[model samples]
Target: MQDIPELENCRLCEWQCGVNRLEGELGVCRIGRPKVASAVLHPAPPQSYTIFLSGCNFRCLGCQNWSIAHFPDTNETPRGYVEPECLGEEAYDVVNSREGKFLGADRIFFSGGSPTPSLPYVEQVVREARKIGDIKVNYDTNGFLTVDSLKRVIEFTDSITFDIKAYHDDVHRALTGAPVEPVLRNARYLAENAREKLWEFRILLIPKISVGEIKPLVDYISGIDPTLPLNFLAFRPNFVLENYKGASKELMEKAVRMAKEGGLENVDWSGRVGLPGRLSEKTSDKYENKGGEIAGGIAKEAGCVTHPRNCVACELEHECPIKNYRPAKKSI
Candidate 1:
């Protein structure tokens, strides 16, 4: 934050791996350099020119972008390496595109395996982008940054989409391969010091590991300030959890209720469905799966088919959870 010049002992993320990234030493991310995976105009919420960087500190079983996030030991030539200035310029052009300038795209989102590992590069991009024209930066983070790095992030970025995977430390470790302290610290820091820059705190509602975590997380945030915004991302079956069905509308409703009862305000999730029946029963009816879970057809009828993490430009994006969640008439 003040002047983290060399990567001799990288303490960028919460891992504190202490590996010398400058000397070809790799940390848990398995990447020693700033290698990006892809960049595109994403229309998730307010559309953003999202940049995805390679490597992550967490090894989540439900990683949606595992293909890029977890890089295998391959002999092929590596790609997706771009200078920070070029990326910043490209983002500036996309946000100010002539054909449709006002379609709610106003920010350049730094996403990844997690942005913590690319603090220097991302900050440079933010600076370069702002130099060209008025630009806004949003960090889609896992909230594992150190206090100093977070201070620098607050100095530059306009808003942050902070992630809180689990509330309990043991459950958090079991789910994400990381402790819950750093995320909790950063979230509390933002709520207390930089509330204006805090866009929202997000939690992925995993079926067994994290569904029950919603209440504790809500209570923690309520302890800080119930007015802080929280978004519950219904878990999409991905990677190791592929066979499992996504979090049901009923479960998330209970989550919402708990949060509201805990005195939280502004609670919303990604796509809404169901008519009082639980995800395990009734809804599937004639077309139940062999395991009695929600089948593809039933999910399609309800609006989501266990959404993929990044569903940009897909034909059926209208029904995807990452893009939209149509609430029931009563809830609306």
Candidate 2:
């Protein structure tokens, strides 16, 4: 696949500002030139394991990593870039270190503000990681990539955790500053083609903003496959909308019910288990809460108890949230 020419005039993301990202041109996503932020061997909860990339495609009003996503003008800009080979090397090291040192990780995840915006860079990273071993590679994405872009990277990915913001185009646009059409299209395409691969749909049930839109979003997902796992995240205000309140438990339950009523067979809550204050502590509380819920909820729904028995012997125990939770005796 050829590098998107738009990468040079990068409107790949929601910002759609035709900025030259390859020539060190910074667009709304803030990543200039090459692959920016990268971390290997991180323990992402509920989702198991993965690598994280920086930069984003959307200018979410309540973005958590505003520093990275919005590219704060005050901080020193990152100048270094990690090549795909270097990324692969780092991933290999992480896998080896985890296995040799008894770190309990079984998967690799590619996450970002919107990873599809940097398909070429991510493809390079995934291709290299695949060379090391047969690790399950997953993409945690916003479901905004064009079909052509999705086709290019879909083969390299083993699973996808796709975020569906809202069912209606207007609501989706209002919430994320991007249209819902592309997201919906990609979701349907992935469901049909990537069904054998674990394809989970996530929705953030924002208090006032997203509640009414739940039925439509759930209806759309149900039409694809009622058995597809639909995750509902409780919204917390942070980043740009610090004053916005977190979704009430009652509201979250209502959204979950909406999904079930829409004929969705597999549904789970990716919202806060019980902590209200934890949302305020994070930079992008809403985004963090959404991500945490997706990771945690999906893991629990998969039959791995909140506190997996294997977690006790893991070296990264201190950092593992999955082990910290009291086991839910009932299945989600």
Candidate 3:
């Protein structure tokens, strides 16, 4: 594997820890070299060969793909260090295969724990893949990237599926273990500047957990441009929130209505609904926001030692129990 010299002073995401990833110094993401957890020919919209990258910058409590997201901390053995050119060529072949065409596949999707941590590697892969053929590329992101990093993403990706976990700072922090400002900022940047490349702004509605975020989030997005595509994802119980109730069909419908009412012209909802589970009794009175309190409580129960869940600033950044948490339940 070739070294990214920039990894010597890595500042790929908002954390900007400046750690030498090549020399094994860890940052909030804790990934040194980018590794592929897996790759599959997915049948979802914008269907393509989905490349799951290992490791993430956020310690999201209800992470559906926790094993891949937590990576080294979670005992996940990734397909360690495929040469960028090799993986890129593989992605090209996979997306252009007969199986890919039968599934309506049209692009190579780069998803992860969150792709921000592996931006350089992804960029390199795109370069190599495009060299093989005119392969379209889609980037699925958590929207926690820095301004410069987001710019690079927009430059390379044919389309982007951006995730906005929550709108309010407190709720966002508690849910994702990171601040919401950067994510919102990046979302705004995309909507205002690169709307054509944005596939959609995906908001996962986790019943009581993220219900409150819809109105404010819709307002924020519509305020920028009501025509910007927005999708409400029905959250399933997973990771630390494994026992938490999944979003109901009624709630998903209501979310779409709420977004449309809030002036979002292109609003819709999707995902499996109503898988059985109970809401968490654990909750913190520390946060002013109800959603934050609930999510913060779950994070606490899962051994996250920080209130407000600032993983980048927390003393346990390297030794984070949330990153190493082994959930008893796996929703999938």
Candidate 1 TM-score, true structure as reference? 0.78
Better of 2 and 3 by TM-score: 3
Strongest candidate by lDDT: 3
- TM-score for each predicted model, relative to the true structure: 0.78, 0.73, 0.98
Model 3: per-residue Cα lDDT over 1-332, one tens digit each:
78888899999899999999998999999998888999999988899999999999988888988999998898888888889899999999988888988999999999989878888999999999999889899999999888999999999989999999999999999998889999999999998999999999999999788988999999999999999999999999888888888899999999999998999899999999998999888898767788999999988888888888899889899999888888897665
lDDT of 1: 0.69
The TM-score of predicted model 3 comes to: 0.98
| Ten residues in sequence with the least summed lDDT for candidate 2 | 323-332
Model 3 misplaced regions, further than 4 Å? none
Please provide the root mean square deviation of candidate 2 (C-alpha atoms, Å). 13.1
Decide which is better by TM-score, 1 or 3: 3
Instruction: Extract clashing residue pairs from model 2.
Output: 46-295, 46-296, 50-109, 64-284
lDDT of each: 0.69, 0.59, 0.90
Which regions of candidate 2 deviate over 4 angstroms? 1-6, 9-19, 25-30, 45-49, 72-79, 99-103, 273-332
Task: Give me the displacement of residue 271 in model 1, in angstroms.
Answer: 4.1
Q: Candidate 2 on 1-332: residue-level lDDT in tens?
A: 23446578775543456778767665545566544554545554434345545656554544554444443232425424677777766676676674623656555677755666667777777778778776667788887776777776578877788888777654554345455678888888888887866567878776556666777788888898999888787776554444456678887787778878889889878656332422322222122233333322333333333222122233432333221223222112
Candidate structures ordered by TM-score, highest first:
3, 1, 2
